[model samples]
Target: VTFLCLPPVSFLLLPHALALWACTRSCPSRCTCTQEKSCSVLCDRINMADLPKEFPCEASSINLDKNNLKFLSERAFGTLPSLKSLSLDHNNISFITPGAFKGLPNLVELKMAHNEYIRYLHTRTFTSLKRLVRLDLSDCNLFSMPDRIFIEQTALKELLCFQNNFRRVPGAIRGMENLTHVYLERNRIEAVAYNSLLGLTSLKYLNLQENRINVIHDEAFKDLQQLENFYLNDNLLAELPKQAFKGLSRLKMLNLGGNLLTNVSKTWFSDLVELEVLYLDRNQLCFIEEGAFENLTSLITLHLNSNNLTALPFSVFQPIYFIGRLYLFRNPWECDCSLEWLKEWMENYKLVRDIPCASPSSVAGLDLSEVVYARLNGTCVDPAELNLTTALPDNPTTENKFNILISKLLQQELKEDLVNSTESFRNGTLLDPAESQVSGGYNGFSTGRALLVLLSMYLIQAETGPH
Candidate 1:
């Protein structure tokens, strides 16, 4: 026999060429096949009305998304023991027989999202996919699932079920201990009852935003000890139980924006010591009790903008040591003596946004930084002239007395600095209006005086009550 001469690259590609030729011969009509580490078939958007009757046995992945397939018969994909991934998203599939996915033992991912006609599924639909790690069934108009639907998928890790008609969290997810992420946003969920999420110990992220959730049981999330990120924004929550978030110690970020909360209670977050970012914006909050965030020592960013707050007591945020970003804009701030501590605090915490005055028309619309002591109707007492020792009661506590003296000393120095700055501004020695608005304006200020007046009004309130 004549010896065939071939290059080294051709020799290496010979096996792949033979595999591709075999896959092409077995590939069904209107489909393409290629040889990678394994065979992959692309039959997406083919306008097919049924699953292809023939597929290469060696095919490890298939994409049939955006097709007209409306029904899935039993054993739809016949005994593809090597199939690892399948995408049937954006199809018109409305019915799935019990054993439709019976032969996909090694399949790790199954995406059938956007099949809006599918509202119910048989309990044994996915019973054979024991090794499936990710499942996407979102936008299927599903209202509920059988209690034992996911009882066998112990290896499932992520579940995406957003934009559905579910009235509550599916009870089928109660025992998914290996699940790490769940997306249930934009659903019709009305409440989160206790034990609704009973045994998901490995969960790290949960999204329930844009739901109708108005109530959360006290221990609803007590089992999620490892959860780190939670989103509950744009809900109808008017209030939460005091112990609603009791056991979530590792949570780092919480979003409660766009809710109906009228006040914030201190007990709601007493155990969240590792929390770093908090979003409480766009609510109906008019009051926040003292020490509301005392346990959040690691808090870094806080959002209190777009609320109904007229004034906030300074003690609510005194415990957060690492706070860096504070958003306090778009609220009805009453610029009075009780708000003097806020002005003093914002002067040092330069990362704070501009807080405009809403009452006492003289300072209305003016930033808190621009409102001088003289404009507060002379309500704030000059610390240099006030006697701290005489202001105290007959038998004052040591902590109270120490805090009063420190507040007096701080106010005295701040008053003197303000007087000198005002005099310089009048004498044309300070920066111009444009320069001041850019350099030492509301967005930019010096540090080191943030804690100066932290406990001033709080301690005073304890002795003399609100100013």
Candidate 2:
């Protein structure tokens, strides 16, 4: 071996060169990189407080979910033009600066959901993502959207903003020309104002379910000419004006369940000519006008369960020639001679179940559908003699007014009776004396009579059930 002594400067330089090699090799910290020949990174649930400085250069999809990110700066995603999908869900992000996603020109899908602190927004935060297609901001605690958060996003097709505090539909989305799906469900939206959905001609799916909506203007959906599925269920709507759903001629599925509706007036479904599946369950509906569903000839399934309906005129469902499924359970159905026509109509469909009757204690819980009309002891009126038409004149006659007044008076009396009985039972004041009449102040009626009235009143509440 030949003697080969290096200079003193080489020893000091050797340590510095070794330090540089370790720095370059430590770029994949706090994240797992997995790609055979392509570039992609998944940095999920690593408790990252900030974006990794040395991410994959040519990465396309970056998943940084379940982190503790508080803010997304403009330079968060550094100059990655090939990035296509980025998911930053379950973060505590409260703010996003302008051009936050400026470097991601080719980004297609961006999901920032479950960020409970991201309530307020700036208009230009997402303006740089022109090529983005699907954007999900669900469960963000947002009260309202910015004026132009989605400006110039012509290629955007879907925008999901569900489970927020939005009081109404975001007006900024009216400019998007090619969007096909928009989900705003489980918000605090109060009403659907006219022109709120205007300029969304290409919108096919619009879901506004589980909101606080109490009103829907007749022209609210006028601009959605191409809309197909409309979900307005689980809202606070009490009553809707005639033709409240106009201009959605192409609408197919309509969900108005879980509302406070009390009546279905004529022409209610007159505009939904091509409607197929209609859900009106879990409401307080008691009356439905004739021809209410005459225009829904293309309907396939109809759900009217969990309501307060007494009797539905056959004319209401007469035009629905090809219904596939019809659910009428959990209602206070008055199964009398009035349901004779329904017996024949129900047999036409095989999916119909045994409907339960809530009236006529003799057949109270019995299945009205399975009742053998031929073997029954009761004499049913002739089908032609049983008039099913119920006139609802705007200007009722004096006699009609008197009848209404009497009906209200009777309801008040029944209410008072129930209250008195409940109070007597609660206070233990109910009579227990074995009394004999012919005295100065004889006990009114017998104990048996009192017990009978109380039993009947209690049954009424049990039959109606809870709201």
Candidate 3:
């Protein structure tokens, strides 16, 4: 070999030049690499049919998104021991051989979303990813998964499997106690069986929205005691068991919009004392029994819009003290004396949407806020004065007769109180004591006493009704 002489400065730069050469050689053609902190390779949208033969040994992240890759061979990426993240989104990958991710012991996240052709995965495809914290398999055509595929992923916390063809919640996630979030929206699931979500005790957020689910077993979510936000909107649920939500004590936000629910029951929410925001819009609801929402003491936002409601009992919303937003638009409201209390309540909470009248031709198409009280010509006849033997429904069930009696009694009591208050005001006996030194302060006090009596009677009647 011929001897070569160089400036002294060349020796000082030699190590860096060698390193640059090695980096360049390791980086595949049409791919970009950054050496900051550690190597991060980007091979997105390269139209490649296979993974590059070589990648930097120190690579911490690799992006192979939007490529033509169809298969992942065994030990395909085993050389990148330091890899922490790998993204293969928007590929046509349909198969992943076992041991393909074997050597990546430190991998923390893997995104394989939008791989539409991937209908199945090998049982051991992710067996070595013990430290994985997130795995996104969304937008795949997957209908099922092996039950033990995720047995070794002890540290996984979030799983995104939305937009798939699954007919139910995957049984593979049953024993994943560390899992906190699971997104299974936009699937073809038809129901939630009791064992579907049995063992995920640590789950906090669960999204089953936009599915075809129509039935839910009473104990389907009994294991999710820690769940905070639960989404079941846009399903086909027409009814639920009395204890359908019994174990969700810590739940906050609940979405039940876009369903076929026709009525609301008090026992359905007996255990949801901590619930805050509730969505019941876009349903077929026409009736909500008195005290239906009495247990929702922490409720803040309520959605009842886009339903078939004609009237609602004021007592239904009396227990919720923190209510701020109330959605009541797009409903066929009868702007009668029954809804006068709603107007008064709306004035106190201006966030409530305007109610549009659908009956009583005079107020038809008019906003409830603009209708004068005199326009509400609906009358509430006192049931105590009527001949119950003739006025009551013939051949009625005990439950039906009890419900009718309670409704008429409540209406009569409300009407009498309103009439008394109006008469006192007109007679100058209802003036504020501090402003006018009125000697009839007793009148105002009597009104309060009457309300308490009415509430007590209602509660007593409710307690004695059918279970």
Top candidate by lDDT = 1
Q: Output the lDDT of residue 5, model 2.
A: 34
lDDT by residue (tens digit), candidate 3, 115-155: 99999987898978999999999999999899889989989
Across residues 1-467, which tens digit of lDDT does each residue of candidate 1 receive? 11143223475687776677666778878998988788999999889888889788888899999999999999899988888999999999999999799888999999999999999989999979999999999989899889898877999999999999989999999979999999999999999999789999999999999999999997999899999999999999999999888989999999999999999999988999999999999999999989899999889999999999999877776676579998999999987667778788888767785899886665677787776653212245322243221335345564756565666555555565585563324354533435545766742222213344445555656767666
lDDT of each: 0.83, 0.76, 0.82
Those runs of model 3 whose alpha carbons end farther than 4 Å from true positions after fitting are 1-25, 375-467
Scanning candidate 2 in windows of ten residues, the lowest lDDT window is 382-391
Residue-level lDDT of model 2, residues 1-467, one tens digit each, is 11143223465575444333333343458776555434567788989998877666667678889999998888678887777899999999999998788888889999999999997888888867889999999999899987677776889999999999999888978757688999999999999888678788899999999999998887787778889999999999998867787777899999999999988877678888899999999999898888788888789999999999888777666777788988999999877667767777777656677689776554676777655442112355321111222322455544553454344344444455475663223244433323323221344344444554565555555556766
* Span of 10 residues, lowest total lDDT, candidate 3: 381-390
Greater lDDT among 1 and 2 belongs to 1
Per-prediction TM-score to the true structure, in the order listed: 0.78, 0.74, 0.76
Which residue pairs in candidate 2 collide?
Answer: none
lDDT of 3 at 318: 70
Regions of candidate 2 where Cα sits further than 4 Å from its true position: 1-27, 36-38, 374-467
